[model samples]
Target: MKDFIKVMKALSDPNRVKVIKMLQQREMCVCEMQEALGIAQPTVSKHLKILEDAGLVQSRKEGLWVNYRLSGGGSPYAASLLGNLKHWIETDPEIIALREYIPGLQRELVRKKQASPAETQKKDSSAAQDAATERRETHD
Candidate 1:
């Protein structure tokens, strides 16, 4: 009963549920989840921790990345719940939208983004400024 309550509580959050759903598709790193959910890295970590504690998810080290995936054979309760979840609420519009983006999400891309986030933002800002300047000149 305690394990069940913990698992239920972990699944209570929509973000955590989304994390489980995302992991159903493929193993993901925290950075990949952050990009998919448009949330901060710390938040993703928190959700992962809760899920891990609940035995719904597990992580393993892969190089510099810790990849998270749905647990297969941990607690029977967790495994049963995970199996059911694969078919549950999958038709939700939010889930549909998330599914659309999952195929394009890659661990390497997330790593690259994290590696030079500031540089990427600077480049994006410069590009936007250049485009604005061009528009202004045209209007003038």
Candidate 2:
């Protein structure tokens, strides 16, 4: 009963459930999750921590990032609950949208986006300049 309640509480949040759904498709890092969910890094980490404590998710350090995925082996209750959840929420529109968005969410892209703000500003300025050049060329 305790295990069941813990699992239920871990899955209580919509964001945590979304994280589970996303993990079902592929492993993801904190930055990728932040970008996909449009949530802050700290919030995503908190959700991941909850999921981990419930034995529903596991993490491994790879290079500079900590990758998270659904735990395939854990307490029987957690494993069973995870298996059922895979088939349970496939029809939700929010879940469907996340599924569609997952394929394009690469870890590297997220890392680049999370780069220093100055670097991002420079990239943005360069892109604007290129766009202006293209417009001028088209007008000539």
Candidate achieving the largest TM-score: 2
Q: Residue by residue across 1-140, what tens digits does model 1's lDDT show? A: 88888888998999999999999999998998999999988999999999999999999998887889998836787888899999999899989999999999877877777777788888899999999999999999
Which ten contiguous residues of candidate 1 have the minimum total lDDT? 108-117
The most accurate candidate by lDDT is 2
Per-residue CA lDDT of model 2 for 57-108, tens digit only, reads 9999998889999998467888998999989989999999999998998888
Query: In candidate 2, which residue pairs get closer than 3 Å at backbone N, Cα or C atoms, i.e. clash?
Result: none
Candidate 1 Cα outliers beyond 4 Å, as residue runs = 115-140
Worst 10 residues of 2 by lDDT: 72-81
Segments of candidate 2 deviating more than 4 angstroms: 119-140
The Cα local distance difference test for each model comes to 0.90, 0.92
